[model samples]
Target: MNIALSNTSDKPIYQQLFERISAQILKGELENGYCLPPIRQAAQELSISVITVKKAWEELERCGLIHTITGKGCFVAELSSDRKLQIRDEMISKQMLLDTSYYKSFGLTLDDVIAMLKKVY
Candidate 1:
């Protein structure tokens, strides 16, 4: 697993971690049953607090994105394609709504948003 923390961003480190891992799972970058490093090990590797990593892992579990086994560590959950797509759309749509609200506050039109999205997408 790979994650980059942004200390300057409004998002917490754990939230960033959760989003990255969630994206990987939904995109099939992380396959079902793929085991993740232990929280302590992942924290050491990322130079983040163990608590932060633990919270992220917990959030992944809360979202049904990962499953934990006693003593075995966390693994990506097995999911049907339809279920994966459902979660993916739900997460993406929620974030998109938050972003669109910001843009709307700035009086940006849908065309303006499309133009901006086009630049990166």
Candidate 2:
């Protein structure tokens, strides 16, 4: 339910919203069945477009992180600890694939990337 959007980030606004919300849900910061603000309300509060909020919500549902009920609003899905860890690993693996590809294009080895990541992380 808490989010801080970065206008200068390379990622789109909707993507930023989706990532933040999903991370919270997976980390149990947002409990199972917790109601998310309506798309229009969230858009207004975040000063973003309604369409952006809608897209992020749609992504959450698509990823099985949340579900929507007609007239009831979207709620976080019930996830066990194992399921949360699985989803976290899956998401991280996917992102790492892309990052590895990017690093490879720059001729950076795994050790080089790890060193750089350590510095930033």
Best by lDDT: 1
> Candidate 1 — what's its lDDT?
0.95
Model 2 over residues 37-98: C-alpha lDDT tens digits? 99999999999999999999999999889999999999999888898899889988988998
- What is the RMSD, in Å, between candidate 1 and the native fold over all Cα? 1.3
TM-score of candidate 2 to 2 decimals: 0.90
Q: What is the lDDT of candidate 2?
A: 0.93
Per-candidate RMSD, Å: 1.3, 1.5
Which tens-of-lDDT digit does each residue in 6-46 have in candidate 1?
A: 99999999999999999999999999999999999999999
**Pairs of residues clashing in candidate 2:** none
Model 2 per-residue lDDT at 95: 84
Give the clash count for each candidate.
0, 0
Checking candidate 1 for backbone clashes, the offending pairs are none
Candidate 1: worst-modelled 10 consecutive residues by lDDT: 1-10
